[model samples]
Target chain A: MAKHVLRVVAVVYVLFLLVLPVALIVWRTFGDGLAPFAEALTSPSALHAFTVTLTVAGWAVLANTVFGVGAALLLVRHEFPGKRLLGAFIDLPMAVSPVVVGLALILVYGRFSPLGGLLESWGIQVIFSTPGMVLATVFVSLPLVVRAVVPVLEELGDEQEQAAHTLGASRLQSFVRITLPGIRWALGYGVVLCLARSLGEYGAVAVVSGRLVDQTQTLTLFVEERFQNFDQPAAFAAATALALIAVVTLLFTKLLRPKDRSDGN
Target chain B: MAIEVRDVNKSFGTTPVLHDVSLDVAAGSLTALLGPSGGGKSTLLRVIAGLERPDTGTVRISGVDATRLSPQRRNVGFVFQHYAAFKHLTVFRNVAFGLEIRKRPKDEIRKRVMELLELVHLEKLADRYPSQLSGGQRQRMALARALAVEPQVLLLDEPFGALDAQVRKELRTWLRRLHDEVHVTTVFVTHDQEEAIEVADTIVVLAGGEVVQAGSPGEVYDNPANPFVMRFLGPVTEIGGSLVRPHDIEISPDPVEGGSPAVVSRVVRLGFEVRVEVEIGGHEAWVQVTREQADRLGLGPGDTVHLRPAPGARSLVLAL
Candidate 1:
């Protein structure tokens, strides 16, 4: 009886905390009609905001994939001085608040900073630009891929790679043929996590984007702008779209990622 | 190819793993590096395969100095203890991986892979992934994959160490037959004395990062160079000033002149032979007798018996 009551309580908690809110947003989004939602989605600024969000997320995922796999391989395979320090640094983005991460990036790349000023003198702009938003998103999502990949790499020791090398396969050939296939599932899952984190990132992107309309605004920022301007329908519509994307990504990842066999066979 | 390893030494951090180890494996001969755990057998195998670099040594393969060459350039086949097959690939593809990397023609690769699959007797399971195979089957696949590259020297690091007892026995016999058929210069590491004696043409015994003895199986068993080799190969009993093997001791119910009188302390019945423990000269000594002989003698615990070293029995007296 106690177990039954506990299960009921957990279900009710999830329904209230997650299901109800999403249901309310979806109802509010299309409650009046599809006309307002369509109008908000088709608006030039709204379209640009979605475009910027996706572009920045795309670039962030790409960069994070390369850097994350490299870092994971290094941490798992090699021993060096300051290796633990480097490992701790990989998790820094996860521990620090995204807003703080944004502030830190600004301090390093702002117009007043030495590197930023030099770039500005060369007719380049990073702060308050698309590149700034990408940098912030990458910083926020950096840990996701590395954390996912490191354990898998550690589980797969150097035996298969060594076998390949002894079998007359070159280093690159061995990695491509043996090592990569062995870790493909982990790498794919890491990429999906990086994409999800990059897509929904708002705190760091908001601080670095400068809230410029149609120029640096993302979907989350656009929703906030609409809500502050008393455009409730537009806000709910944008939120609903973002929620739909997240749900689709979740479902896709669940369906396509390799099954987690406990035996590791 | 003939392998000549000269004065190989290796150390991990501050601890030495391989001492100044030198060995020569003739072409078309199977050599077993037999030792206990952490005895540097695997390290020496890796050094010969070019999977590991000795800190200060030279490795010559087929009369060529291969010390500076990488593993790929050395052209050696190495089988790991755990059967490191590519998990994602089917049996056919796993065996064909080396050929694929070498850019062999597709049909030729297919032909060669199928031939190897037939050789390992896994032709019906060609499309199956490694995860679906049994432990012995997976090891066979690993062997086939190693042989796919047609390497000059074949090195196996305890290839049968991970299998069950029955499967290990079966594979040991199969490996002997395979070596006879292929005749590649093969070097394998194992800690099992019986396996080494059964499969290797030459047995190299290592202990504490040093080679204790290297000789033919019969030579080593019959005439051990030291107490370590004698005790390592089989049970040994020290009588007076010499080491005697258990099989060399003869036990009888009646006391014979000039023979030692002892009390039978224990009797352990093995399948073909019975091991009888007797106290002789205030020391426990083991004597192996056939079951028929034991029954005829009626020897059991707490029985009076006479123990004597058989005539022409080999015994060794070592300094250390």
Candidate 2:
């Protein structure tokens, strides 16, 4: 009886907090007709925002995937000084607010900072540019891949790798043929999570992007700008697209989850 | 290939796991490192295989110094207790992995893998993944995969420790037959005394990270060098200055003229043999008797009995 009550409460909470908001956005985007929705989607600024979001998120996911796998391997396989410190630092992005992450990046890459000034003089713009947005997205989603891959790597002890080594496989060969294949699912799951988080990230990208009209404004910022300008149709259309991407990513994550092998055939 | 380890010492952090361990395994002989858990038997096997580096020692394979060599270059095959078969690869592909990495011809790789699958009796399930196989079948696959590289020496760390008793017995016989056919120098670690006695041509007994004794099974059983080996090989009772095995003590209801008076403290029936515990000379001693003898005597706990060491029974004199 208590379980049923709890289930109802959970279902109602999800409907009000998640399902209703997304459903309302989709309804509002198509309420007038397909004509307005089409116009909103094909608008130059909307298209540009999408391109910027995808470009920054794509690079961020790729960079985080490589770093995540390497960090997970080091944490699981080796014993070195400051290993615990490294692990703690991996979770910093998760613990800190995304706005704080954006401010931190700005402090490091801002015009006044020596490194930022050097890069600026060399015509390599970081703050208030695409690179800055990418940096913010990477910082916000950095922990996703590492947290996902670490448990799987630790669960798969060094036995298989050692077995490969003893079977006359070199270090690189063992990692490529054995370790990578073993952790492929975890890596994929991490990539999907990082993708989702980076796509939806707002505060960090906002603070770093400087909200340039159509150049640095990502899809989330575009939605905020459209809503502020009282263009509900355009805002809903953009938000619906982001929601669709999130839904697709969630499905992909479910598909990539590791299967339980204990149920014998 | 013959393998040698000299003065090998290994320590994890500040705690020592292996101490001054030395061993020599002959070519094409099956050896067992028999010891209880935490005795460093597995560590010694890994040291010989180059999987674990000893702090101060030399490992040689077929007279080649392998102490500083990596496991990849040592040309050793290691089988883990959990049968670390690749989960994503089919049995056939797994067996072909080593050969494929070595860049062997495709046709040769296929032929070798098929032959190994048949050898391990998994030809019918060659396409199946490790998750689809039974524990025994997975272990057999692990064995076949290790042998695919034709390693000079094979090291197994408690190969059958994770299986049921029935499967363990069957695999033990199968492994012995496999070793006989291949004639590769093999060293396996096991805490089971029966397994070591039955499967190994030579037994190296270890305790507290040290080699207590190494000899043929019969020799170790008959003439254990020290108290640790005697107690480890089987149950033993220290009487006066000698160590006596349970099977060597005779139990009778009638008071023999020269036998010691004792009370039957416990009687345990173990299929063909009955173990009778007797209290004699202010100490407890175990006596093994046949079921028929036990039935004839009709002895139970708290019954009076006489105990005597059988004539010609092997006994080792304790050295202080």
Candidate 3:
């Protein structure tokens, strides 16, 4: 009897907090027989926003994957000064508000700053551009891969790596052959999460991107602009698309959960 | 190839693990570094394998200085206690790893890997992943994987330490037979005295970061350099500043002349033998006797007896 009550309570809680809001938005999106949904999503500005979101997310996930794997290896495998500090800093983005992150990036890399001026002189723009947007996305999602890979790396000790070394494997060869494959599922899970977060990130990208319509606008920003302009149909359609993407990413994450100890086929 | 270490000293964060240690292993001979845990046995084995560099000494493999060489360049095979099977590869690929790294021909790799798998008796499970194998099977696979490269030297750090006693014994005998057939210069670290005795032709006794004695198994067991090595090898009773093994001391309740008069303090019945601990001249000495002998004597606490060394039995007396 108590178990049934708890189960019903959980169902009700999920219905209100998650399912109801999502279902309403989805219903509102398809209420007009899919015509407005297709027309709003197929617009020039909406399509441009989507490509921009994909571009930023692509670069951010790539950068985060490389940096996260390296940081996890260093944290778990080596001992040095300030290792704990570095680990704690990797988690800073998750703790701090994304808006603050955007402001911090602007403070350091804005056009008037020294480093920004240097980079601008080299014909590379970092602030209020695609580079700044990628930077913000990368900073916000930096800890995902590292957190995913660190525990797995710790559980997987250095014994096999030493064995590989004794078997005459070069350092790169051992990492490519042994270390990377060992962390495949965890890495995939992290990548999926990072992609999800990058696509949905708003405050940080808003501050860093300057919110140029059809230029640096992302799908998320497009939704906000459409809704504020009283174009609720387009806004609801974009929201439903993002919801679909998040659901897909959730499914991927479920499948990529690192439970099985795989040694290849 | 032979191995030589000269005055090797190692310290981890100011704590010395191996100090002034020197050793020499003959070519194609099986050597065991036998000692208690934390006695630097594994550290010394790693030093010779080029996994750990010595602080103030040199390591030579087949006359080549390997002090600064990386393990990859040293070409030594190392096996760990936990059987470091590549969890991402099948048994066949795990055995074929070294050959593949060396980029041998595909056909040759298959033939050599199959040969090693059969040698280790894992050919039937070649397609199985490490996660699907038993602990003993994984360890056997690890050994075959290490031997695949035909390394100049093979080092094992407590290779059977994770297995049960039955499997450990089986692997010990198997290792000896395998060494006889392959004859690669090998050095294994083990804290099991009986294992070192039963498997190794030469035993190097280590204690507290130093090599106390290095000789044949019988020599190290019969003649220990200090109390630590004496106690580390096996159980001994201290009598008048001399250590005598239980089987070395003879107990006679018939008042034998020239023997110390003693009282039987305790009698313990272990498997296959009865241990009679006797107090002799205010010193404790253990004597081993058969069950029938113990029963006939009816020895118990407070019984008077005479204790003396058995004929031709080696007793160790450490100078204080």
Using DockQ, give the best candidate's number. Answer: 3
TM-score, model 1 to reference: 0.97
Best by lDDT: 3
Question: Could you report the DockQ of all the candidates, in the order they appear?
Answer: 0.64, 0.58, 0.75
| iRMSD per prediction, in order | 2.3, 2.8, 1.5
Chain A TM-score per model, please list them. Answer: 0.95, 0.95, 0.96
Candidate 1 lDDT over A10-55, as tens digits, reads 9999999999999999999999899999998988988999999999
lDDT of each: 0.89, 0.90, 0.91
Q: Candidate 2 regions off by >4 Å?
A: A1-12, A258-265, B250-259, B294-306
Q: What digit string (tens of lDDT, one per residue) describes model 1 on residues B1-320?
A: 49998999999899899898999899999999999999999999999888889999999999999999999989889999999888878899889988988899999999999998898999999999889999999999999999998988889999999999999999999999999998888999999999999999999999988888999999989888888888899888866557898789777788876578888899999999998988877888888899999999988789998877788898887464
Cα deviation at B49, candidate 1, in Å, is 1.5
Evaluated on CA atoms against the true complex, candidate 1 attains a DockQ of 0.64
TM-score of 3: 0.97
For B1-320, candidate 2 gives per-residue lDDT tens digits of 39988999999889899999999999999999999999999999988888889999899999999999999898888899999988878999889988988999999999999999999999999999898899999999999999999999989999999999999999999999999999989999999999999999999999899999999999999889887888889888755457889788777778875678888899999999998887877877778889999999999889988876788777788787
TM-score of chain B of each: 0.96, 0.95, 0.96
